[model samples]
Target: MTRSARRTRRTRRMLSVAGLGTAALLTLSACGSSDSDSDSGNDSGSASSSASADQKLTGKVTVFAAASLKESFTTLGKEFEKAHPGTEVTFNFGGSDSLAAGITGGAPADVFAAASPKTMKTVTDAGDASGDPVTFVRNQLEIATLPGNPDKVASLKDLTTNSDLKVVLCDKTVPCGGAAQKALDAGKLKLTPVSYEQDVKSALTKVELKEADAAVVYKTDVKAAGDKVEGVDFPESADAINDYPIALLKDAPNTAAAKAFIDLVRSDDGQKVLTAAGFRKP
Candidate 1:
């Protein structure tokens, strides 16, 4: 072969080698791009998983509520526990005045449900509430008498006029007591009770146990007593309906769970439970 022909053959071999090297580089670049895309997708999925894990609720929520809320709050607490697998709902039910004192005194509660706005103010004034309290329900006073209404107590005045009837009233410091006094004032009547109890439930219990012929208490408490007592509605009670308020405590130990519980209490489902227990809507 001539020298020029040999050079031409060499040039062709060089061109072929360059072409192969370019193809290999392109292949590796394509593979690297695909791997980067796969890694990005995995990162996105991992972030979503982390976000979901962060939102899972777990822990205990302590609630300080009025005695009148026992039945309905207990039902709602159970529902809250069911909705959050790892959560627990605990309650301290008692007179609104006492519960307010407990919360304002740093009782380590996550929530406060009061029988009256006046009671709730004690906590709010002390800066113990996270936000402004919301009125969730209202309740009217009723005269609870022994089973079958042995005293024939038909109105608030009946308890006042029948000096021998043996009546019980809640202490004026509590919501029920304040409401009863309001009703009596509205009707311009006066009554001297055989005893002044600390809470509505205590007043109702007096009638249930036959310790008293009648007692001025909340409609809900009367309904809760079932066949243990009889309830008599009075026109004056309509003028003195107590507004119930609830709030999240400022230093709630379990904020997430506390918020969730409040949401449930204000929900339609919760309203049904309260209304069923004889509490009026707010």
Candidate 2:
């Protein structure tokens, strides 16, 4: 072959090799871009799922509630747990004043439900509540008596006059006791109880257990006691009505779950439960 022809052939071969290399580089770049796009799409989907999971309520919610709310709140708590599959609800039921004391004293409770605004104020005053307390229900005082009117007790006056009948009253510190005192004062009646119980439930229990002939308690408590005790509605009881308030604590461990639980309590379903238990709507 001629020298010019040989050089031309070499040049043509070199050009073809360079073209192949360029094609290979382009193909690899395209593959890398495709993989990157796929990875970004996957990352976006994973992030969306993570965000959804974060929005769901999980973990435990601790509630400090009034003793009278035991039945209704327990039912509501079970319902809340069912609604939020992974959530747990634990309750501390006691006198409103005592629960207030616990919350003000730095109790680790996510929610606080008090029998009276006065009691709720204790927590709010301490800046422990996250928001303004909302009244959910109202309760009226009633005279709880024996199954049958064995002592012929008919009214508040009857309770005060009967010297032989054993009687129980809630201590003035609790909501029920405060209401009872107001009722008694409205009627201008006075009588010493055989015992001054800490909560309305305790006062009611005394009558149910036959430890006392009669006791002043909320209508809801009397109704909850079923056949264990009888309820009497007196005219004086109308003078005092206890307003029950509830709020989320400021230092809630599970703020999301705590808010959800509070929503459940204020919902129509919650109101139904409260009314069914003889509590008046607030």
What C-alpha lDDT do the candidate models reach, one value each?
Answer: 0.91, 0.92
Write candidate 2's Cα lDDT for 1-282 as tens digits.
999999999999999999999999999999999988887857675775466546789999999999999999999999999988999999999899999999989889999999999999989999999989999999999999999868878899999987998999999999999999999999999989989999888999899889999999999999999999988999999999999999999999999899889888998998999999999998
Model 1, range 1-282, lDDT digits (tens) per residue?
999999999999999999999999999999999988887867685775466447778999999999999999999999988978999999999999999988877799999999999999999999999999999999998889889987777988888788799999999999999998999999999988999998888888888888999989998998999999888999999989999999999999999889879988998999999999999998
Superposed by TM-score, candidate 2 places the C-alpha of residue 15 at a distance from the truth, in angstroms, of 29
TM-score of each: 0.81, 0.81
Prediction 1 global C-alpha lDDT: 0.91
Q: Which clashing pairs does model 1 show? A: none
- After superposition, candidate 2 runs with Cα above 4 Å error: 1-54
